[model samples]
Target chain A: MSTVLLDGTEQLINGLMYGCFYALIGGGFTLLFGVLRRFNLAYGSTIMAGAYAGLIPVYLFNAPVLVLFVTTIVVSVLVGLLVEFCCFRFLRKGHELAPLMTTIGMLIVIDETIVYLTDAVGLKYPAPFGDESLALGPFLIRPDYLAILVVSVVSFSAIFYLLYRTRFGRAMRAVAERPDAAQILGVSVRHVNVLTFVLTSALAGIIGFFAAVSVGSARPEMAAWLTGKGLVVMVLGGLGSFPGAIVGGLALGVLEFEAVWFLGSSYRDILAFAILFLVLIVRPGGLLGTRTA
Target chain B: MEYYVAIGSIIGIHAMLGLSVYLVAISGQMSFGQQGFFALGAYLAGLSTALWGLHLLPALVLGVVVAAAVGLLVGFPALRVRGLYLAIATFGFGEIVRLAFLNVRYTRRIGDRVVGPNASEGFRHVRYIYDRGITPLEYLGIILLALVVVVILFYFLERSKLGAKLRAVEEDEVAASMIGINVTRVKVFGFTVAAGVAGLAGGLFIHYSSYIDHDMVALPLAIASVTYPIFGGLGSFVGPLLGAVALVGLTESLRTLHGAREFIYGALIILTMLFRPRGIVDEALVLRVKGWLPLRAARRPAPAP
Candidate 1:
């Protein structure tokens, strides 16, 4: 009994640590959805593009970790801007699925371009911190996991500050609430939309760098998988809720770890989608979301 | 000869899938889980013929019925959400079904060989057509027959009163309800029929390939199934058929391009959406074609929705 309790506690801590990553990714997705009322299926692919771009300097010049991080954010911002221009900017006010379908097209293009360049092979990614673990009372925690938790929390706080404590954030929220009214009030909906994309893409870049570090490899296929997980996390928390994304991601991480412990690795993804299905059924607006439509 | 025949069969099967998407799409519910119904139909139909030693027609019927029944069960809970929520919910449903199949490992010994789904290793040796010595041409004919029957059903449905109700719900649910359109019933009915048609497509697909796998019905298939209707035209049932043929034909032609095929395909979809957002077979195109034929009264086309 004591051993089981120890394992459960360890799992809980580890799950919360992993949940930070999902929170970061899901937060980016929710931000985009909140501002535009549309999903950029290419969001993960844009991040993947940034990661791969960062990898080039590492491969050719063996750049330091900071250079790689900087490169990733720069490239991610550019790719995010391009996606907004092609998929969202002009296609706005068209059919409901127009932007979605266009993003999917962009996703395929980005993923396939990466595959073509890299021959669809995974590349080794260096972790910022060395591979070491800290033992904390019957638990072994990796240093990188700690780093991820810190970075994710700080990032989340930064986003909260930007959203709530700034003039731009107010404009963003106004646009999200009512685009026409915001336009009438001279919010420049286009600027808010572009800026929102930039913010989320930068967040995605940071998350991607951390993900590549923890996994110790970068692959093109990660885009679609990340997109799926981000969507699941976004819906599980609430469609357009920010805080909800954090709570939902953390809960999913914990539940996923428990699933892996009780069942097996094979059942991990199943558990995620099963919970999502149930949440959508019982609470259509999500755990922290108010009912809409 | 055999290659073209096989391509034709695939196009027919995809057309069936596209039509299923069209049915659900016209009702205003954007489902990303029709592939779930397809997987169910494929597995169930394959099992009936391979494991139970049933005939092809009966196996296909069993597949359609089971998928349609599950669709009805799914439709109620699914009806609670709208727009992106509905799309994500259906997407979750699709992932659940796919993952479930990934873990399922049901097999039995038939004669001297093992058959049935073997988890991620995939279900193989579903050789009902091969065992019967059916040729590729004959299989293609079978698929075309199935497609024809489905098209006929869609043709009749397009002219029926329920079709109007379905479109009415798509336009505005509140107004539709106020007009006594029974919005819930129309949406659920559309969902059920779409699942059934997807099941039929899967039944034919497994027979042709002589294999079934969870990965085969994953996200790509779901995306392609929906893309066909949207790409071809959403104006009428004929749109998906045309879309399926054109897009699949493009895919087959681009097979020789190696790495460039997918890149070009993606670019083309983007370009098409930019140029013709309503798809290749919108109301304008239909009207223009009608004008070419003699004795047709020219009615002004409805502006693109």
Candidate 2:
């Protein structure tokens, strides 16, 4: 009984740590959706491309962790901007499905390119935190997980500050609330859209690099997998809600870990999807999403 | 000769999948999960023939029925959601079906041969075509016959009242409802028929390949399936068919490109959207082609002054 209790606690802590990682990944998706009211289907692929660009330094010159982060963020932002320009910018507005289709195309292009260039091989990356565990009164936590948690919290707080306390955040909010009204009020919707893409891409790059560090390697399929998980988190957290994303991510982490503890490893993905389906059905608005229309 | 036949049959199967996507798409709902129904049809049809010793026609019918029923079940719940939500819901459903198939281990011994979906190893020895000694040419003929029938049906549907109703709903659900159209019924019916069409394609696919695994029906397949209708244009019934033919031909011809085929597909989608927007075959092109045809009724009569 005592062992089971310890196991449960460990699972809870670990799930939360993983949840933070998911939240970080999901943040970009939700942010884009919140501002644009359109899904960026290429979100995952752009991040994957950014991570691949970052990996170049590691493969060629054994770059430090900071260099990796910087390269990933810069390349990711550039890729994000490219996606916005090519897929989102020129298309006529009100044709909702067009943007989705274009982004899906962009996603395919980026993902296939990564797979081709890497020859589908998983590559190693440097991690800031080594594989060390600290025991705190019968609870054990890994250094990498702790680092992820710290980063997730700090990043989300920064996002909150950006959204609530900054001028740019105010313009973004205004645009999200009503593009026409915001435009009349002096906010350039196009500029906000591009800036939002940049911000989210940088966040994705950071998280992608962190994920590579945690796993010690990045594979071509990681982009799709991360996208899938990020979708689950976004939906669970209530579509475009930032606080909801954080909560949803943590909840998903805890729920998934507990599910694995009770059932098995295979149940992890199944559980996430099942929850997404159910949430969409019973409450399409999600835990934090308000039903639009 | 065999290679051409195989390619023709594969194109037919993909065309069927494209039509299925087209059906849902014409109704204004974007389902990225038609592959779920496709997989269902494949597995169920494969089971009936491989395990129960049924004939091909009945097996295919059974696959269609089961898939349509599941689609109806999905469709009813889908009524509550619209736009992106519905797409995501369907995507989740597709993944669920894939994962379930990954873990499903139902096999039975029949005359010294174990047959069924054996977890991830995949269901093998579908043997209907193999056992009967049906030539690849013969199979291609059967596929073409099926494709022709589906095309004719879609052609009629494009002119049918139900088709108009679907288009109206796609334009605006509230307005459609206000105009006394049963929005729920039309959407649900579209989903059901689309699933049936997808199932038929899947049944054909499984028999041709003689094997299937969860991975084959993954997200990539779903994307490829949707890409057809979008690339083809939504203006005419033949749009998806044209899209499927063109895209599949490109992929097959570029087989030696070593990953560039998919890259091209992605680039084409972006370029098409940027330039064409309404796809390569839009309403205007369809009108122009129809005007050139010798059919007397193809031309619209001028308004009397």
Candidate 3:
């Protein structure tokens, strides 16, 4: 009974840590959908790009955590801009499926590029974070987990401040709410779009970096799950809901961890989406979304 | 010659998949789950023939039936969600199905040998057709015949009430319902039939390749399936066929370029979307091309009645 109790507590803490990270990733996806009203099919590929970029400094120059974070953010922003120009900008808005197709094309391109760069192999992180764990009584939290929690909290809080507390944020919200009206009112909708893409891509980059840490390596080929989970999170939280994204992301992480706890880990991926599918049927608008026309 | 036959057969299978995607699009829905149906068909057919010594024809039909049924099941709830939600839900469905198949344990026997699905090791020795010694050319002929049959069937379907109903729903679902067209039914029917077509393709694919696995239907394949219809222009059935042929041809030709195939696909897609947002073979473009044909020129009304 005591062992089970200890295991449950440990799972809870670890799940919370991961939940926060998932929230960040999900938040980024929801942010894009909120601002752009289009799904970034290349979201996962950009996350992979960020993860790969994060590793370059560590492997070649033995850069510190700060360098990795900065590099990932910058790289992700660039990729986001590229996607916006190459896939999204030229697309005719409100077209049935043009944007989606273009994004998928971008995803294929990025996936192939990463595979070519890495020779279809996984790249190990210089900072493995496997050897260190913070112990408190009967629970042991890995350093990476702790870092992920802190980063998630800090970034989300900053995002909250940005989205809710700033003039630029208000401008962004106005554009998202009514792009034409905002444009009429002299809000440079384009500026907000660019800013939103950069900010969300940076957040996705952070989440991607943590994802690589959790996986113990930067795997270009195996990075599709980040996008899948992000999609699951975005939908669960509500397509254009930020707070919902955070909650959905955390919920997905905890749910997935609990699934691993109850069922075997081998089938956890299957159960994760299966559960989300049921949720989608039950709550089509998600926990926080308004029904889209 | 064998290599050419194999390539032709693969192209035919992809064309079928592309058509399946095209069907769903005609009914105002998008599905990235055709790959899931494809996987289901392949595995089910493989199991039927390998385990019970069923004939390939029956196995293919049965597999298609199962795929269509699953499509209806997935499409029913999925229909409630719109656009992005539907796409994601179907995607989730595909991943779940793939993972479920991957974790299963199933087996069948050959002459003094047993083979089956082996967790991550994949399903092996699906050699029923190959073992029967049907040549690749014969296989190619068989698939092409099926494609022709499907084309003819749909050609009639387009003139039928069901196709008109589907087109109505695609134009406007509320208006379609208002006009007593049964929008949900049409949408579900489109998805179901599309899945059946995808399943038939999957059955053909496994018999051609003579192997099966969970990863056989994956993200790239699913996305490629979706892209074909869009790339070919989803205005009509021929668009997907044209798109599949051109895209698959491009993919094959680019195979020799190390690390450049996907980049080229990406670049082409981007350029196509920019220049030909309607795809390379939209109705307008087709009419234009047809006007230049020798037969159309020859039948030019002779400047009199």
Best by DockQ: 3
Better of 1 and 3 by lDDT: 1
Candidate 1 chain B, poorest ten consecutive residues by summed lDDT = B293-302
Worst 10 residues of 2 chain B by lDDT: B294-303
* TM accuracy, model 3: 0.95
lDDT of 1 by residue, A266-288 (tens): 98998898888888888888989
Which portions of model 2 show Cα errors greater than 4 Å? B110-113, B287-305
lDDT, ranked from best to worst: 1, 2, 3
DockQ, all candidates in order: 0.69, 0.69, 0.71
Candidate 3, after superposition: displacement of residue A162 in Å?
0.8
Candidate 1 colliding pairs: none
Off by over 4 Å in 3: A128-130, B283-305
Candidate 2 residue-wise lDDT, B1-305, digit = tens: 78788889989999999999999988888898999999999999999999899999999999999999999998999757878878888989999998999999999987777789999888888989989998889988888888898888888988999999999999889999999999999999999999999999999989999999999999888988888888898888788888899988988888899889889988888988887777777778888887788784646586799
CAPRI-style quality class for the chain A–B interface of candidate 2: medium
Total backbone collisions for each predicted model: 0, 0, 0
